[model samples]
Target: MKRKPPTISPEDSELFRDAIGDVRRIEAEPAAPARPGPPPEPRRLRIDEEEALRESRRAPADLALDAADLLSYCRPGLPERVFRQLKRGEYSIQDEIDLHHLRAADAEALLKQFLNAARRGHHPCVRIVHGKGLRSEGAPVLKSLVDRVLRHRGDVLAFASAPLNQGGSGAVLVLLDER
Candidate 1:
């Protein structure tokens, strides 16, 4: 049978408003704070894509060569050719990883990526951002699992926490073996 819905009493509505006198009506209000100024232009670091490919092709062991060694390949007076070459975005590719919301079910995916990178003959290094467990109810799970995986992972060479500019103690720089 069709029936009309009961109507809320006008007195009840008046009582509700009186009870919430100071509280603003959220549904009819400005969503965000007023902006002080226009947004700034974006900046990007110069990157050499070709050199990056060649750098990735070089065997992982070759990366151990110090700046003194690159001096033999390049011209003289280049004090930090090794580090410069790496930062050119050619030989060493840097990527950020977030474990903030990673599930236990996704560990296999991480393993697969590690194995694939090793097989490609690249000195693949990645920044894994496992945030401090401040918001988590228990101990940090992703960092713990990553540590366990590294223990048994053949492709892993070594891993260490990054410096302050590189995600600080919250992230790790992982060095993978040759593919």
Candidate 2:
């Protein structure tokens, strides 16, 4: 599909030159001395966040927790009645995350992110289904991870194993503190 460009005959070229009379070469004004662009916007926050994410992805130290055992925690100063309510699954779960088959590190990261987002969205309660880790080689990895992570988070006011009708010991109902 390539076509050769139409070339003017030598006579036509000479006619064109004659018609033009005279010409002078014009120089491009030297490209205004290349000024450096504005310094790159600071990425300190993004870099720090990336580093933290990477750190969070590293496998957390394992904890001893059986797959069938119920999990629960109430932050100091949280009322016993509130913890009891969480255990009863009385609070409507506004959100949920299932970490059924995910690895420990990935589950930890996702659990943290989900909790943070839930807190920011003003969700008072959420459920996490860690699946009782029935397929794990040794201890239930994700169940233990969820327990550890929730305990350390400042916004997690209380958490307990869901009641039998609501996934029983396989999932937890969490009560989050208002942000």
Candidate 3:
């Protein structure tokens, strides 16, 4: 009963046909290398682990003490007698550690902990391993840092580099305050 689409004008019909053909061609084209889909699954977050890792990353100080600044005061000019005394452990020293394997991140906390503990126990001396810093970059990081930390700590009375027999210049013996 319809009147043949009401006689769509030749131009209009041609345009409509062209559009249909174009759409058909597009749909028939090889599906674009199977466009990559979303990731397989939702990522799981480890809240506690992330928090612990973040806390660990925080440096010991808000204002990082420059290594050079630490060096200016932590001189290696301790006397040989002091070195000998440290080796003999004649001054109520608690621990003589060989810090060869300690990582840089750990050295300060260990030093502070040891000093704090020794102070409480009325311990007089302790030995530290600076390891000559031959492998470390820029003026032996551990030795310099340790020196600065010790000099700044109230518990330390004195510290000197060791003699050849006792870790040579690679180590230092620290005398802690009896308080």
Candidate 4:
């Protein structure tokens, strides 16, 4: 037979209750484990991946701009004199953007956006100030990126380094198609 627990006598229980302090109850519940969520979006591109993508979507031969050389390009069929005038700062700048401290990727994206907006607004001329690589470890990163992107864009009619007072080699004067 199962043994029963010894019961306290009423007088003993009263004596125990008097010895012990009053007790309180809590209404809180235990927390459950958190569920997993979806994976995060990718942010950075690997060097090789970036190079490969750039190569695959490379601009046509006539439109490609070199990074090492002077920043200048004009779509075929445009008058060479027009580019010369652009180099001399003859065109009035309708808008401008500075890419001084931005990374290569960010500079490229901003340039693309800026060009799009300029074109939409029918801005004939714009200035892009890409600082000289004085602070960079090697070649001017933003300057080269701007050169490449500007050359590849169909909306870009031509681009040339700005005049001395306007920033010289550290900046570019971009001519965008009216459309």
Q: Whose TM-score is greatest here?
A: 2
lDDT of 1: 0.50
Write the residue-wise lDDT of candidate 3 on 1-179 in tens digits: 76664778999989998877854334565656777888654122234334434654563544433322312222256566764565554555476766566776687667666666666676676667767776775567677667656656644557766555665567677786564
Residue 101, candidate 2: Cα error in Å is 1.0
Error (Å) of candidate 4 at residue 58 is 6.1
Question: What ranges in model 1 sit over 4 Å off?
Answer: 1-93, 118-121
Q: Cα miss at 47, model 4 (Å)?
A: 24
Task: Identify the runs in model 3 with alpha carbons over 4 angstroms from their true place.
Answer: 1-93
Which residue runs does candidate 2 get wrong by more than 4 Å?
1-63
Positional deviation of residue 148's Cα in model 1 after best superposition, in angstroms: 1.2
Q: TM-score per candidate, in order?
A: 0.43, 0.66, 0.49, 0.63
- In model 4, which regions exceed 4 Å deviation? 1-53, 56-69
Q: Which digits, one per residue and each the tens of the lDDT, describe model 2 over residues 1-179?
A: 99999999999999999999999999988677788889765365345446655654674655578988999898889889889988998899999999998888788779878987897799999999998888887888888778877766666789999999999989999999884
Model 4 scores a TM of 0.63
CA lDDT of each candidate? 0.50, 0.84, 0.60, 0.79
